[model samples]
Target: MKRPELVCPAGTPAALRTAVDAGADAVYCGFQNATNARNFPGLNFTPAEMEQGVAYAHARGAKVLLAVNSFPTAGRFDLWREAVDAGARFGVDALIVADIGVAAYAAEAHPDLRLHLSVQAAASSPEAIRYYVREFGVRRVVLPRILTVSEIKDVKKEIPCEIETFIFGNHGLMVEGRCSLTNYVTGLSTNMDGVCSPAAQVHYDKEADGSVATRLGDFTIDRFGAGEQAGYPTICKGRYHAAGREDAYYAFEEPISLNLATLLPQLMAAGVEAFKIEGRQRSRAYVRQVVGAFRGAVDQVLAGEDPELADLVALTEGQKQTQGAAGSKKWR
Candidate 1:
C-alpha cells in the first residue's frame, strides 16, 4: 500500500514552520480573514506571511495548502476572490475550498492550481464527490468526520478523486457549513463569517460555588467545577438544560477529540491518500507535538510494524479522545 500523507495544521506563520520542521508532508492554513473558517484573531497568515510560509514549506520539502474554504457572503465575494488570487500568486501547492463558487472560480482563474474539496463541503457520497471532480476538477475530497472505515472503503471504490480523512483533532459531529448554533447565540455566522464562538465575545465567570461558567455572549454554554478544566465555549460542544432532564447535559456533541493513531494502517489499506490533523486554532507547540508523533507513527506503519504513539490525552479537548464514527457504524 502507498504510504498516506501526513497533513498537519498551521494556524500561524510560526506554526507553519513548526509543522514543516516536525515532519509534516503538508500544512494547511488560511488567510487572516473571513475567507477561512478559523478566522480567530492572532491566527492565520497575512499575504506576506503566506508567501513566506509557502517558500518555507517548499524549502523543507513540505507542501502548503491554502484554505479559501468559507462561503463568500453576498457583495463580499471580492474578498474571497482576492484570497484565491493571493494563494495562486503565493505558489501554494493546493487550495482547500468548500464553497462551490470559490471552487469554480479557483478552477477557472487558476486552472493549473490544485483544488482539494474541504471537509466543510460535507460531500460524503460517490455521486456528490464525483460531481465536484466533474464540474470543478477537485483533485481530492476531504471526507466529513461521520463516515465509517467500511463506508469510506466503499466510497473510495466509486470516487475518482483522492480521499482525505481527519485522522486526529476535533470529533466534528455537526454538519459542516450548515451549523448555525454559534450564530443563533452570538449573531456571528460560522459558515459565512468564519467565526465560531468568536473569542471577543467569549466570557468566563467564576460562580460563587467555586465553579466556572463559560458564556458565549449573554448565553451560558457550560459550567465546569473548580476541579475540572474549563473548555472553550462552542455552541455544539456546550452543555445545556433540557426540559425533560433535571440536570444539564450535552445537547449536541461533547468536548472530545478524535484519535486515530491505531487506525493508521487500516486507513491506508482503505485507500486514504491523506490523513488530516485538524487544529488551525491551536498553538505551535500543539502543531509540533501532534505532527511529530504522527510522523513517527505513519513511518512505522509503513514499515509494517505496529506503531507506538506517544500519549496525546493532555493535548486533546476536554482531556478526552474518541475514535469517532470512523471506528464503528453502530447507528447505521
Candidate 2:
C-alpha cells in the first residue's frame, strides 16, 4: 500500500513550525491577503515570514505549499500574480490555486514550480480535473468534500493528476468558493474577500429563557439553550425559518466537523495521494494536537496496523463530529 502524504494547515509561522515538528509531511499556508481564502486577522504569513517558514520546514524535511487559491477579480489579477511570485521566490514546494487565469500566469512565469488545484475550484468530475491538468499542467487536485468514497475511486481511475482530499476539519456542505450568504449580510465576498461571517458583524444576545441567540448583522443565525454550546455565527451553519417552518432549521448544513480517521485506509486504497487537514484559522495548540494525532494515525496505517481514531471532539466545530458527504448523501 502506498503511504499517502499528510498535508496539514499552517495559518501562522508558529503553526507552520508546530505542524512540521508534529510530523506533517507538508504544511500549506497563504499570505495575509485576499489572494488566499483564509485571509482573516491574526492568521496567514507575510512575505518575509513565509521565506523564513519555508526555510524552517525545508530544514525539517517537510514541504511547504503556498495557497494563492482565491479567484482574482477583474483588474485585480496583479494581487494574485504577486502572491504566486512571492511563493516561488520564497521556495514553496507547490502553489495551490483555483483560477484558470492565475494558473496560466503561474504556468508561464514559473514553469518549474509545482501547481496543485485547490478545493475552492470545486472540480469533482474527471472531465473538470482533466481540463486543468491539460491546460495548466497541474500536478495534483484537492477533491471537494462532496464526493463519496466510491466516486473518489472512479475519479482516480480517470484523472491523470494526483488527488488530495480533506480528512478532517469543517464539513463544508455549501458549494466551495461560491458562497454568497455572508455577502448578503456583510457585503464582503467569502471567495474574493476571504472573510466569512466577519467577526465585527457577529453579535450574541442573551434572552430571558436563558438561551443565547447568535446574529450576523441583523439576521439571527442560531439560538442555543442554556446548556448547549453556542457556535460561531456562520451563515451556512445558522438556524433559519423557511417554508413556513417556525422552528429554525439548518438551511445549509448543521454545525458539525468532518473526522475521517477511520477511513484512512479506504482513502489510500481509493488512490488518494495526500490527506489534507482543514482549520488554517485554528490556533497553534490546535495545530500541534491535530497534526500530531493524524501523524500517528497515518504512520500506523502505513505500517499495516489498525489506526485508532483520536478523540478530537473538543477540537471539532460545534463540538460535534460526522463522516460528512464521504460516508453518505443523507446530508443532502
Cα lDDT, all candidates: 0.92, 0.91
TM-score of each: 0.98, 0.97
Off by over 4 Å in 2: none
Model 1 over residues 1-332: C-alpha lDDT tens digits? 79788999998999999999999999999999999999998888999999999999999899999999899878999999999999999999999999999999999999999999999899999999999999999999999988988899999999999999998997755987799998888899988988999999999899888999888999889999988865558988888899999999988888889999999888999999999999999998899999999999999999988899999989999998888898876422
Candidate 2, residue 124: Cα displacement in angstroms equals 0.2
Give per-residue CA lDDT, model 2, range 44-111, as digits (tens).
Answer: 99999999999999999999999999888898988999999999999999999998999999999999
User: lDDT of candidate 2 vs native?
Assistant: 0.91
Worst 10 residues of 1 by lDDT: 323-332
The pairs that clash in candidate 2 are: none
Q: Estimate the Cα RMSD of every predicted model relative to the unseen true structure.
A: 1.2, 1.2
Model 1: lDDT of residue 285: 89
Candidate 1 ranges beyond 4 A from true positions: 330-332
**C-alpha lDDT (0 to 100) for residue 324 of candidate 2:** 84
